[model samples]
Target: MATEWLGLHFLFGAFLIGAVLSRGAGEHLPRTATQETRQVTLILLLPAYFLLAGLRVDLSALDPSGFGELALVLVVAIAAKTASAFAAARLHRLGSRDLAVLATLMNTRGLTELIVLTVGVETGILDGNLYSMMVIMALVTTAMAGPVLSGLLRPAGGGEQPFSGETAAHDEPLPARHAREETG
Candidate 1:
């Protein structure tokens, strides 16, 4: 853990801070400005980071045991996290959409997982093969969250699915155009 803290931890910490701040800013900013800025930033920055990380990966020491361990870790991670998310969402009375988004975001280990794996490999706590397995686990677990949550939460769209007959259909739009037309 100490070694993991030293090597590449700062990179992920910085990334987390950046993501939080940017997302917070987007939430507060005008929709058009937020969309434009996010698009530009993602287009400019994401590919470069992906390329750099891919180029740095060591692929020589592949191992079967590591793969098995990775599978186990992924199973545990998803089961534990999904259960926890459901509990938390219920406790907070989060709407289905919000709960889905929260679940997806919580599963996104991203660069943080990579940093820990890299540190383990660098410090000999984990071999290259095991590190690779950890990376794979992180990616798979993170990627599944969105689709899973979406499947669970998505409405059929025939009508409003009431949340216990208490919550209103908040996303329903007002008849602004019809009102204007009638007034005019």
Candidate 2:
């Protein structure tokens, strides 16, 4: 909450609180705590946030110029986020397929971006047109993740299950970890 005094967004305050709590309660959190938290946050909270953000978007505000600006924003955002993630992931022993998946997934920037944009509109930092454009940009960029990942991961043969874990994900370690959890 103190972040507002520094002219920062309240999202920073919430994020800071979450990070501090997670760090403090790392050992104290029960086994299912993480799973339960994830389920609640993703299944329940995220959709509500998205809906609230969607309500404020005025489609009429997006004229030809706005559409052009939206296009440019999408290109810059997708390229920047994907390239940075790809470069960072290159340090690992992942293959091209896994790297593409990881990089694309990292570009999923919806909730936080929307929250900031919504606040910007409320605070008059963004006009109605810019808010609509930015909101659409946030949505479109995040929305591309699923189809893009499917395309990147899809086999040339167009199989139902595109790739196997041991191969596509290079997730050999997950199997071992799950096996340990099952018996223990």
Candidate 3:
């Protein structure tokens, strides 16, 4: 709400603060304070966040007359995200398989997108039909991530387990430098 006064999304403000504070993972806090914070997040914040997201998207609010527009939005959202991620991964010299994996994952409208969409609806930036279309696009793209990435990242011979870290691809941990790069 305070951020809205400055014409910034509240989530973006929260994200900026979190990014700065998370740099040291709250080393200034006592261990019990850290543990309690995690507990509160898990026990209260997580469920509330998801519940808010779920409640904001009412499927019946979708306009039957807007099917064509919805279809176009979904197609463009998925295609644009995948193509951009694929191009970026290729530029990074990722392997062909990894490129596909990156593209598939990039298309997902995860919690961050959901939060923004909910905020849009709350702030009247989105009307019923438009919000419905956006929500549908987000749902469809996110739903595709697991199955699509599984197929894209699978190893040869197809015997490896799907999403189990014990698979051949996960046989060895990533190098420390690579892990650091990924985390950063």
Candidate 4:
């Protein structure tokens, strides 16, 4: 089981790394590929992955305690990520649109969270129901990001910065400007 999980992780990691390297190389393979092809490929891969995941779930020794722990972890994970996104947005002084984009990107778990839960189940670290909850948590949190950010960015009145001043971070000051102070 461990070896299978490791192999799966390695394959996923390799795919992600390959994507990053290819993107960095400015390869335009996707541009050449038709939109229909891209859509079909995604549609096919998603169901296959989800089906394999569902098949792997083991439901024999279900426990109730794990649910509480899973809930706590999910809450913490979502809160921490959301708070960090807001903090980073403040520090960077991002506009409403950019902050929303950053928050959305930061909240994205993609397949990574699912992969982690899958590995936990395969390794016997987490039971099936617990794993399912984690999967649900991932889905819910990932889905909420878009709507939450949109709501937060919606205007109430006159123009004001979307992000609060509380978390605003400033970079290093300009030494040249500081040194060349007014002589008057």
Enumerate clash totals for all models, in the order shown.
0, 0, 0, 1
Model 1, residue 176: what's the lDDT? Answer: 44
Candidates sorted on TM-score, descending: 3, 2, 4, 1
TM-score of every model?
A: 0.52, 0.67, 0.75, 0.58
User: What does candidate 1's lDDT look like per residue over 16-88, in tens digits?
Assistant: 7677675465576789997887798799777676565555455456567755776787888766776788678
Clashing residue pairs, backbone N/CA/C < 3 A, model 2: none
lDDT ranking from best to worst? 2, 3, 4, 1
lDDT per prediction? 0.63, 0.77, 0.74, 0.65
RMSD, every candidate, angstroms? 9.5, 6.7, 6.0, 6.7
Residue pairs in candidate 4 whose N, alpha carbon or C atoms collide under 3 angstroms: 91-169
Tens-digit lDDT string for candidate 2 (70-91): 8898888888888888786666
Query: Quick one: best lDDT, which candidate?
Result: 2
Better of 2 and 4 by TM-score: 2
Query: Highest TM-score: which candidate?
Result: 3
| Model 4 lDDT per residue over 149-171, tens place | 66666668735445442212333
Spell out the clash pairs found in candidate 3.
Answer: none
Off by over 4 Å in 2: 1-9, 23-46, 160-184
Q: Between the candidate structures 1 and 2, which one is better when assessed by lDDT?
A: 2
